[model samples]
Target: MKLSVWTYEGPPHVGALRVATAMKGLHYVLHAPQGDTYADLLFTMIERRNHRPPVTYTTFQARDLGSDTANLFKTACQNAYERFQPQAMIVGASCTAELIQDDPGGMAETMGLPIPVIPLDLPSYQRKENFGADETFFQITRALARPMDKTPQITCNLIGPTALGFRHRDDITEITALLSDLGISVNVCAPYGATPQDLTRLGAAHFNVLMYPETGEAACRWMERELNLPFTKTVPIGVGATHDFVKEVATLTGVEPTLDTARLRLPWYSASVDSTYLTGKRVFLFGDGTHVATAARIARDEMGFEVAGLGCYNREMARPIRALAREYGVEALITDDYLDVEQRIETLAPELILGTQMERHIGKRLGIPCAVISAPVHVQDFPARYSPQMGIEGANVIFDTWVHPLVMGLEEHLLHMFREDFEFHDDAGASHHGHKAKPRPDPEARQPVTADEHPGTVVWLDDAERELKKVPFFVRGKARRNTESFAAEKGLSQIGIDTLYEAKAHYAR
Candidate 1:
C-alpha cells in the first residue's frame, strides 16, 4: 500500500470494525497490535457514539510477539465472547499481525463458541476499508441467509449502510418513508440495525435496494446469483435520483409509483427566479465514488452548475468515475494523494467545492468556499440536527449546503460597486460579519520586487496586479500564477495588462 498523510479510507480491518459497531449483537475479535486500536476514536469522537465499538483487540506488544501471540489471541476471543455474549462473532487480523501468520479464524473455531463465527480473510496491503466492509457484510449475509418456502412479498432489504457513514441513518429513514408512501414494506436493512435472524429472513423480501454502491453491491450481487433475487443499484441522493429510485422500485415490484413533488422542495427552489444566479456556477467535486457521482449529477442537472472538475480517491471505483468525467468532457483524477487533489482544485479554481475534510482545508488555503459532502469526515460533518443527503429532505439539505457558500449575484455586484467606501470598513474594527481583521504583515519586512529587481523573472506590472484584484478573491492567486506562467512561456520578463488579457484569453479557450 502507498503511504499518505491523509487517506479516504483506512485499512481493511477497520472496515470490519464499522460492521461490528453498526450491528446490534455482533462482536469482532481483532488480532492486532496496540497501535491499531486508534480506529476506535473515529467512531466515538467523530460519530459521537455513546458506547464503545463492539471490538476486542488483542493489542499484542513486541514482548508478546516474541512469546505466544497465538494464545493471547485465543484468550482475547474467549474473553470477548464471555463479556459481550454476542449473537455472532467475527475474527480477523490486522496488517502487523498478519505478518506473524497466525490463523485467527481457525483459533476462534476451535474455541467451541456457541454463536456463529464469521472469518474475515482481508489482506490489509491488497485492499482498503470499503472493500473490507463489503467482504465482511457479504460473508455475514451469505452465512446467515436461509432458503424460504414462501412466495415473495412487496418488500425489499436495504443493503450497504453501516456506522460512521455520511448521514446514513437519516438516509435510511428518508428511503423508508418514500417506500412506505408507495405501500411497500421494508423487510430488512442490513449491517446497520439488522440482527443475525434478520439476515436469515433476507430471502423473504421480494427484492433488494442497493443504497451505497461501495459497501453493499457485492452482497446484493451474491444474493442475486444465489437466491435469484432482483436488486436496484440506484443511489437516491438528489431530486432526479430520488425520483428515478422510486420509479425503479415500482417497476421492479410491478406497482404504480406515487411521488409528491411538493414534499421535495428542490425542484421548486431551483425553479425560483431568485436562484437563477446559480446557473453555470462552476463546481468542483471530489470524494468516494457514490457521493461524488451523485453530487456531480445534481450540480449539473438540478443546480445548473458547470462541473469544472470531478474525481475520487477510491481507486476500486475508478472505471465509473472515469466514465462520469468523460460525460463532462474532463479527465478523472484517480489517486489517494490529497496533494494531487489540491493541485487539481488550484488548476480548476471552481467557485464551489463539494468534497471531504481534506478538500475543505485545501479550499480554505485557496480562499474558496467548500461544503463537506462525503466521508473521511470530521466531527462537524456529523451535526446535531436532522440533516440528510438522500431522498426529498436530502435534496433540500443539498440545496442549502451547496448554495450557502456562494455570493449572490446582486450582493456581489453591490459589494464591488461600494467596496472602496469608508462605510464598508470602519475604524472601530467593524467588518461584514462584525469581526476584527487580523493585523497585516509589515510591507517593509518583505519588499515587493520590481521588474528591474530580477534579471529573468517575469514580474507583474502595477496595472496588471490591480486588474487581477478585480477577479474573484478565491481565484486571484491562480489567475496571477497562470498569467505569470504564460509570460514566462513566451520569454517575456514583464507581465503588463495586455499580457494578462492574452493569457486569460488563451486559458479561456
Candidate 2:
C-alpha cells in the first residue's frame, strides 16, 4: 500500500505468478494494466528461464477503464486456457487494478472454462506477496487433493518452494536425496515441479515436509487439519539442524536415523582454524524468518561466532523471530522499511552481514563485508553452479559462500595497511600483478562516521581519531563506542591514542 523504491516482496499478483510459473501445468490470468506485466522479467531474467512465465495479463489500458474491464478479463482468461490448455488456472487482480473492482474470481467462474479455474480472492491492499502465494497454493490443493490411500512405502510431500526462490531448485534436489538415504521416498514436491495431477495424490503421502513456510505452511496446516497427515517442522539448513531434521523424520516414519555426514567440512574447518582470528567474531543477519533463525543457530553453534544482531522483514513471522532474538539477547526487527534496516545495521556495526541484496549495497556503502544468504537477491546470487542451501553439500557451499568474504576482507585490510611498506610493496607488485599498480585513495579517507561521531559526552582528540581509523571498518564502530565508554567511566572528557589502546586492553580482560 505504501510506495518505496525497493521492496522485499512484490504485490500479491506477482506471488501468484511465482506459483503459476513454478508448476508445469498451471496458468495465471491477472487482471491488470500493461504496467503491471513487468513481473515476468523477474523469473525470465533473474531466474534465467528459457521461456517466459506462464502468465496472461488483461493489460487493460486507461481507455479500457471507460469501456468494460470485466469483459477484458473474461476474454484474456478464455484465451489463456485455450492457448496453454493448463490442467488448472488461477485468476486474480493486481494491486493497482484492484481499485477498479473488477472481481476477477467471480468473473472467471461465470466463464466456466473446460479446466478448473480457481478464483483467488487475494486482498491486495491488506496483504503482500507471500500471503498471495500461500492463499493461491492452498486453494489449488483444496480443490484438487482428494482423500486417497497412502503410498505403500513411506512417502511425504515436499511443501513450499516456488519459482524465483533462493536456491529452491537445488534445495529440493538436495533434500530429496537426503530423505532417500533414510529409506524414504518423496511422493510429490508442490508449487515447484508439481502439477495439478500431483495435488490429487497429496493425500496418498504418509506426511509432508514443509520446506519454506512463507509459501507452503498454509497448505500444510490445512492438510494436517483435514487429511490427518503429519508434517516436519525442522528445516535442515546447517549441520546441527540437518541432524535434528533426520531425527525428526525418524521419529515420524519409524525409520532409524543414521545420516552419513562424512562430506560435511564446516565443523572441522571451523574448529581447526579456531585460533586464526575467526572465533567470537560478531555477525549481523537480516532476511526471511526461516533463514535468519537458521543462520543464527549456525553462527552460534556450528561456527565460533557471536550473533551481534538478528531479525527478519516478514511481520507475519515476527513472533518466533522475536522469541529467538530474546534467546540471543537482541531485539527483533519486523518491518519492510529498508531505511530502518539500514539504520539498525549502522547502529549494530557487526563485522559481517548476512542478508539480502539490499543489505549487500548497504554493506558496500558502509565499507563492511557482507554475504547474500536469502531472497530479494540479485542475478549474481543465482550462480550457474549447483550451489544449494540444504543437506551435506549445501553445508559446504554455505561454508565457502560465507567464509570467502571475511577471509578476503582481512587480506584486503592487511594490504591496505601495509600499502606504503618498501619490502612488501616491492615484492607484492612484481609477483601479484607483474607490475606496480596505480595507488588508490586511502580507505580511511572514505571511512563512514561511526556511532560515536554524533555530539556526545566524550570527544576524540585528533590523534585518537586517526588511530581509530586504522582499525578495520567493520569493527571500527564498536571500537569507537568502547573507547568512548571507557572515557566516560574514567571521567575523561577528551581521548588520545594512549586512551584508545588502554581502553582496548581494559576490554580485552
Candidate 3:
C-alpha cells in the first residue's frame, strides 16, 4: 500500500464500523490487530459519539499470529454476541487480519449465532472507506430484507445516510420535511437510524430516494432487481436539483407535487443585482463523488460561478465526475493524493475552493478561501447550527458558504477607490478577522511590460493602464494576460486605449 502522512479514507473495515455505529441494534465483530482499534477514536473524538462504536475487535498480536488466530476470532464473536446481544451482527477482518488468510465470516457462521450475521469480504488493498461502507450496507440489506408481496404505497425509503457524513443529520431533517410537505411518507431510512427489521419493510415504499450514490446506489439497484421497486438517484443539494428531485418523485409516484417557491431563497439571491459580482467567480472543487458533483451543479446553475476544476478521490464513481468535468470543458482530477489536489489548486488559482478539510488546509497555506463541502471533514464543519447541504435550506447554505469568501461588489469597488489611503492600504490584511493578507506582486517583477519597462516589448499606454486598474485586483492578472494575448494575436506591438476597448469587445463577442 502507498504510504503518506494523511489519507482521505481509512481502511475498509473502518467503513463497516461507520455503518454499524450509525444504525441501532447492530454490532460489528472485527478480526483485527490491536492497532486497528484506533478507529474507535474517530467516532469518539472526531464525531463526538457518546458511545464507542458497537465494534468488538479480536486485537490479535504478533505472538497470536503463530497460533490459531481463527479460534481467537470465533471466541471474540461468541463473547460479542453474548455481551451485546444485538439484533444483527456484521463479521469482518481488517487489513492485517486479511493477510492471515483466516476466514472470520466462515468461523462466525460455524458458531450458529441466533442473529443474522452478515459477512463482509472487503479487500482493504483494493477499496476504500466509501466503497466499503456501500458494500456493507448492501450486504446487510440483502441478508435481512424479507420477501414482501405488499402493494406499493405513497412512500419511499431514504437510503445511504450514515454517521460522520457532511451535514447528513440536518439534510435528513430537511428532506423529510420536504417529502412531508409533498404528502409522501418515509417508509424507512437505512444505515442511519433503521434497525434490522426495517430492511423487511423496504418493499412497502412506492420508490426509493438515494441521498448519496456512493452508499445507496448498489442497494437500490438490488431492490429494483429483486423486488421491482423503482428508485430515484437524484441528490437534492441545490434549488435546481431539489426542484428536479421533487419532479422525479412526483413522476414516480404519479402525484403532481406543487412546490412552495417562497420557501427557497436561492432563486432571488442569485438574480439580485447585489449578487451580480458572484457571476463568473472562479471555483475549484475536490471531494467525494456525491458532494463534488452536487457542488459543481450548485456553483454553475444556482450561483453562476465558473468551475475551474472538479474531481474526487473515489475512483469507483469517477465516470460521473469525468462526465461532469467534460461538460465544464475541464479535465477531472481523479487521485487519492492530497498533493495532487494541492497542485491543481495552485495551477487553477481559483478565487474559492469547495472541498474537504485537507483542501481547507491547502487553501489556507496558499492564501485562498475554501469551504468544506464533503467528508473527511473537520469538527468545525459539524457545526452546532442546523446547516444542511440538501433541500430548500441547503440552497441558502450553499449561497452563503460559497460566497462568503468573495469580496462584495460595493466593498471591492470602495477598496479599489481608497487603496492608497493609509487606513485602506494595500498591505492591510483581508477584511475578515482571521483571513491572511495576500501579498501584492511588485510592479517591476510583473511579466507584462509598460512602455517605460521594455521599449521593444508590447506596451500599455497611460489610458490603457488606467482602464486596466479598474479591473478587480483578484482577477487583474487574468485580465492583463488575456488583453496581452489579444494584442499579440491582432499583430499589435503596442497596447493603447483603443486597442484595449477593441480587445474587450472581441472577447465579449
Worst 10 residues of 1 by lDDT: 438-447
Ranking by lDDT: 2, 1, 3
lDDT of 3 by residue, 1-509 (tens): 56898789988887788889889999999999988888667877887778888999999999998899999999999999999899999999999899998998888888999989999999999899998899999999889876576544488889999888888889889999899889898989888989888887888777889998887788989998987788897899888889899999998887887577676776676668877888888899999988999899888877888999999999987999999999999999999999999999887888889999999999877767788899999778778899998888888888788787775434665777676676565666454533566645434233566556666578877678877877765556656777888998988888898888888888778
Candidate with top lDDT is 2
- Candidate 1 segments whose C-alpha is farther than 4 A from its true place: 149-153, 408-417, 425-428, 431-447, 451-462, 490-499, 505-509
Q: Candidate 3: deviation at residue 57, Å?
A: 0.7
Q: What is the lDDT of residue 224 in candidate 1?
A: 92
Of candidate 3, the 10-residue stretch with the lowest lDDT total is 439-448
**What TM-score, to 2 decimals, does candidate 3 have?**
0.84
Q: How far off is residue 367 in model 2, in Å?
A: 1.4
State residue 277's C-alpha deviation in candidate 1, in Å.
2.0
Per-residue alpha-carbon lDDT of model 2 for 64-97, expressed as tens digits?
8899999999999989988989999989889888
Clashes of each: 0, 0, 0
- TM-score to true structure, per model: 0.92, 0.91, 0.84
